[model samples]
Target chain A: MLSVMETSRTHDDREREAALQQLQDIERAQAATWLDHPATPWWWAPYFAVWSGALVLSVGYLPGWGSALGNLALVAASGFLIGYHRRHRGTWPTGDIPRELHRPLWMLLVGAGVVMAAATAIGFLVSVWVSAVVTDVLAGLLVWRYERDYARAAERARRRLP
Target chain B: MSAPPEAGHEAAPAPLADLDPVLTAPKRLAFMAVLASSASTDFSFLRRHLGVSDSDLSKQASALESAGYLTVTKDGRGRGGTTTFKITKEGRRAFERHRDTLRALLG
Candidate 1:
């Protein structure tokens, strides 16, 4: 009788462990979704491009009222993109960015900074218009790289799930 | 008489007993896991991720809704519609408690 009771308890423990493991797998899968997300691959590029353009206008690449119009365009475009993403993705990721994203995000910041610095130095020697175009390229290249890295990380996580 | 507890002998209630019963179902637990990270999630996304039929997902979601653990918003009807779920403060608290209990038990 005592042995039977022990065996039952052991079985219960095994079941509990399995459930906990499933819970963990579910959490990981969700984390992957959060990392890669639906709008990640294509949505960011246009937004970043507009942002880069806005930055150029703000920094005197374009003179007078053109800068104000650029700013207005940025705001409107951002609003539309955000709304579209919220509808398409069907979720708002309110949590802190995942740890796996740290590398990509850091790379984005560093790459943008380097591009800005180079553009500034070259602007002195070359034309400001050329430097502004370089900034635009910065947004495109950095977004592409970030998406690639994010997809890779998300895939690795999916593979790890049972 | 019962024997004395030995070095390897166990004498404790099951750890699962401490968990919130509302989250015991794997699908429901997984559902909450997804919703907990995001502010809101749609029904189709939950259905695909949980690998459950629409009816099954609906049942489980209704249960959570009934428990006041989540709120469901339905827009329109038929194919063009959307159903979205958002976790409540109560749900988040319960999920956190359940996670803490699981960790304590596993440790």
Candidate 2:
């Protein structure tokens, strides 16, 4: 004779078809969630690009002697922004660093500050054109490096997500 | 018709009649649905997308683990530990069964 539990198990088998239908409904709902956030990637690129371009153009337009000093300031600002954005996104690449090995991000800020000061002093004591060229080169390098780093970080984040 | 003496005794509790929907609660179901559609997901990725608390996420994950629905692995190091989760074959079957049951009920 079949027990009550055994009978219920048989009923469960009969219900299997219904279970599959519900799963499809759930899957459709989940897919809709992705569509809702579709504009996000398209918006981020143009916004960031405009801000970066403005920063470069502002410093690049300075007079011969002032150009280098302006470029150095731009570099420092760009580095700070890059660090800030990384920290904001919670994607800072310090995950591998041990707690004891951790150093304040202030170190990066300090290094940038020193570069700016050196550029300013050189502009005052030597030729402005020479200072401008050096500062612009340094600024351009910092910005380029940060852009690459940020792109790599974004890619890693994408790969980690479902 | 007269019932037997054994029939007069208390009947066994029904094997969870509403198991389909209950098993696939919105968040857990959503988690599995996402995993089913994707290759895998990491801890922070799921956390940010699902907008659930760490403890809540852990609890839901534990429930799914007990059901043999997912495999969760912890990789990387320190406070920034990386956790990866993937749906299991048994989980896929359970999800399908749950959906089938729901469809039958609706019909």
Candidate 3:
């Protein structure tokens, strides 16, 4: 009698565990779907390119008033971008950055930093505006690369699901 | 699951009786789990993710909505119409409880 009860309990446990696993997979698959895009549209790279370049130019070369105005413009553009992303995607990602995206996101930040450092170095040799343009181009390329990496990483995560 | 359980959940598991009844159904549980990860999800997207027919998804969604676990918003009509679902605060709390119960059961 005791063994029979234990066996039944174990069976129930297994069934419950399986159900739990399925629910978890559902959550993860949804997360993967969200991560697949994560607010990045085709023009995301170009928008950041112009925005970052303008920011650099404003801080690096503009007078006080011009820099303030540039900051205002940047804020407005950012707000617009957020609205556009939410409207088009019909979802707002709101959670810790998924582990799958961590590496690519870190690489993007590091690449941006390296490019900015290089741009600053070049500014000393060439014109500041020229450095801004160069930074703009490089930033766009880095963002594009990051987008591809994000897509690949998200795809790998989706493949592993279930 | 895309990830494993974190290590700190190794304590004595809770009893199965603690599970949320509203989340007992597989499709409903999965639906809430998905919603817990996003601010709002569209109806079509939920249907695709849940692999349910439009009517079936609507039925499940309506059940949850009636339970005050989620809110549904509709825009436009017919072909151009869009419906979106957002989990309510109560829903999130319930899901957390259900998930914790599941984790306990696993342990």
Q: Which candidate should be chosen as best, given TM-score against the real structure?
A: 1
Off by over 4 Å in 3: A2-10, A36-41, A58-66, A119-126, B1-13, B74-82
Ranking by DockQ: 1, 3, 2
Relative to the true structure, candidate 2 reaches a TM of 0.39
Worst 10 residues of 2 chain B by lDDT: B7-16
Please give, as one word, the docking class of candidate 3: acceptable
Q: Model 1's CAPRI class?
A: medium
lDDT of each candidate versus the true structure? 0.75, 0.56, 0.79
Candidate 2 chain A minimal-lDDT segment of 10 residues: A93-102
The superposed Cα distance between candidate 3 and the true structure at residue A69, in angstroms, equals 3.8
**What TM-score quantifies how close candidate 1 is to the native fold?**
0.82
Shift of residue B52 alpha carbon in model 2, Å: 1.0
Top candidate on lDDT is 3
Q: What's the TM-score of each model vs. the native?
A: 0.82, 0.39, 0.78
| Model 2 agreement with the true structure over A42-146: per-residue lDDT tens digits | 334443444444444445446776767766776786687765443333222211222211232333355456646756776678755556555656654544444
At residue B105, candidate 1 shows an lDDT of 62
Relative to the true structure, candidate 3 reaches a TM of: 0.78
Instruction: Note the DockQ of each predicted structure.
Output: 0.49, 0.11, 0.38
Residue B34 of model 3 has an lDDT of 74
Q: Candidate 2 at residue A89, lDDT?
A: 36
Supply the global lDDT for candidate 1.
Answer: 0.75
- Lowest summed-lDDT stretch of 10 residues in model 1 chain A? A32-41
The Cα RMSD in angstroms, rounded to one decimal, for candidate 2 relative to the true structure is 17.0
